[model samples]
Target: MTSELIAALRARLGDERVSTAESVREQHSHGEGHHAPSMPAAVVFAQSTDDVAQTLALCNAHRVPLAAFGAGTSLEGHVNPPEGGISLDLSRMTELLSVNPQDMDCRVQAGITRQALNQILRDTGLFFPVDPGGEATIGGMCATRASGTAAVRYGTIRENVLGLTAVLADGRVMRTGGRVRKSATGYDLTHLLIGSEGTLGVITEIQLRLHPIPETIAAAVVQFETLSDAVATAIDILQFGVPIGRLELLDEVQMDASIRYSGLTGLRALPTLFLEFVGGPEAVREQIAVVEAIVSDRGGLGFDWHTDPDQRAALWRARHHAYWACLAYRPGYSAMTTDAIVPISVLAELVAGVKEDIAESGLTAPIVGHVGDGNFHTIILVPPTPEGLAQAWALDRKIVRRALALGGSCSGEHGIGLGKREFMADEHDPVALEVMRGFKKTMDPNGILNPGKML
Candidate 1:
């Protein structure tokens, strides 16, 4: 049956486009997370919407599970197929279909990466602001409903995505929404697929709302004597309506790793806030003044603001490389990153408790977060031993349970691909989970689309 499936895919997509090669299968077997890799029976590169529809049709007919692959950067194991079948490679379908400058929106194939789209829009003074700190394809971002530091001011993928084109489980082509800003119409199906994690269907194209380049952008890095002080400052800034473009937090350990790895100097190895304010020069200055007062009241160190474009880029460049820096702290160890979010009022409590837990566990975990919105991550590095794995998983679950107890989510940006499936029941009501399963059954009755993920 496996051989028959491979032959059928090769016949339709051409031999070069479909492959059963061991190396190719291995490449599509996992994402960036720590989930165990499972090789697919075959990998098919879909270069167009028609190509995706045809592949889905064949998979549906054969009752073979199908998983979509983009840049393979999902940290929740969204692209991995625990049950072996066809891995639909969509990175080749990258095309900027149309750009409506007047409407501040654009259309593109799912395979286009966020950086690629922003680069294409540079000349037009518009950019796609969803930066997940990796070379993540837009389709994968939509699939997981990803966000980044910019999410605080701009918003996550859920808000930026205007519409999408997808291929349903049974091979029928589907399109939802349009350039119109909002619709009061029936069931918002576009949103249903945005964060579905590809269990319902394969997203082929996306129409994204864009933001204009800020007239004056300034970045600042400030340190705090204590983690509580740093988090309090972040909370206060937001409460006061600072309108900062980005607000990030890095614990002392992460700051040390980042400083050493990124070759940055003069930053004290302490709990810190990396902030960016956007607007006209005067407006940015006023926001900075307001933020400085809040930070000072919370015992934050003096702000070091960067106005030069090169300096500002250098600051964020070091931040975007944070995960790599944290991993470098312990060579030959795997990092199982955890994502947890809480209300701003409880973020300080959560971070403080998690830090003490990591120290008590004797783990080398560096923390970083988009603290403006009360979302944070911990890169827990552990050796490749049974005991090490056990310790890491336990620490991860501890943090997750604490977040849920504090009216938070097990995941903020990372979707429940395989890692957080167990916590779905804990994080959501049983009825919510059942309704989701019902939706899955309705869309892909055969359970041939990305099985063993989400539900």
Candidate 2:
């Protein structure tokens, strides 16, 4: 059946666009996660929306399972083809469809990456704010409902995406939402597809909201003798309505890893907060002043400041590389990373509990997060043994339970995908899961769209 389907794909998309080659299949098998690879029978690269529609039509007709692949930087198994069929590679569909500077919105093909879009908008004094570290495709970011450091101010992909062009499981192209900021329209299917992770359909184009690049941007790094002081300072700033552009926390382990990984000439590896403020010069200065006083009250050390673009960029560079830094912190060890978010009130407690769990489990895990929004992540280093893997999962569950107990969620930004699917029931109501399954069945009746994901 796969052979017949492959032949059909080649006939439609040309032989060069369809591949059953071993190397290509292997490349399309998995993402950046530690999940074991499940190679698809074929990889089909789509160059246009029409190409996607036609290929999806073929797959649906053949009842051949298909998984969408974008920038392929997903940390979970969002791109893995567990039930091998066609790995629909959309990386070639990199076209900027439209940009409306007046309306502060733009449309682009699913394959255009975050960096590419921002680069295109660089001269316009406007930028897309969703920065989920990595050269992640805008479509992939939309699919995952990704959020990052600046999310506290500008919002996540969910909030910024104004519309989507999605090809359903049956190859029907549907456009949802529009350029308007608010609409009292139908079922809001745009949001339904966002964070759906391609389970219901393949997103081919996205209409995204854009924000003006700030007139003045300032970054500061503050170290604390205790994690409590660093966290408290962050919490106070958020609670005080600072509208901070970015607030990131790095525990001692993560700070140490980042110091070595990103190079630091005059900084200590203590519990640290990397902060940013963006607005008019006066507004940024005021925000920084308020945060500075808060930090000083909490006994935070040297408020190393930098308004220079190069210095600010370097600071974020280190924060973004925390994952790789943690991996390097324990050479020859696999890292299992988890993201759990709690209410601001309970974030400190949750972090303390997570620290305790890491110690009790005897694992080396570095913690980093955009804690201004109460989401934190830990990269747990594990041995290359079955016992190590089991221990990592056990710790993950403990962290999830802690968050849930605090009236938070199992996953803050990372979607369920293949990693957090088991925790769906634990996080959501049974009725919610049933409704999600209904939506899935209604959309992809043949179950060929990203099977065995989410609900």
Top model number, lDDT: 1
TM-score of each: 0.99, 0.98
Relative to the unseen true structure, what is the C-alpha lDDT of residue 400 in candidate 2, on a scale of 0 to 100?
A: 89
Kindly list the per-residue Cα lDDT of model 1 for residues 1-455, writing each as its tens digit: 66777788888889999988999999999999888999999899999999999999988888889999989999888888988999999999889999989899999999999988988999998999989988999999999999999999999999999889999999999999988999898788899998899999999999999988999999999999999999989999999988999999999999999998998788988999999999999999999999988888888878778799988898899999999998888888988999999999999999999998898888899999899989999999987799999999999999999999999999999889998999888877999989999999999999998898987
Cand. 2 Cα-lDDT: 0.90
lDDT for predicted candidate 1 compared with the true structure = 0.92
Q: How many angstroms is residue 323 displaced in model 1 relative to the true structure, after the best TM-score fit?
A: 0.4
lDDT of 2 at 80: 94
Question: Residue 406 lDDT in model 2?
Answer: 91
Error of 2 at 351 (Å): 0.3
Predictions in order: lDDT: 0.92, 0.90
Question: Which pairs of residues collide in candidate 1?
Answer: none
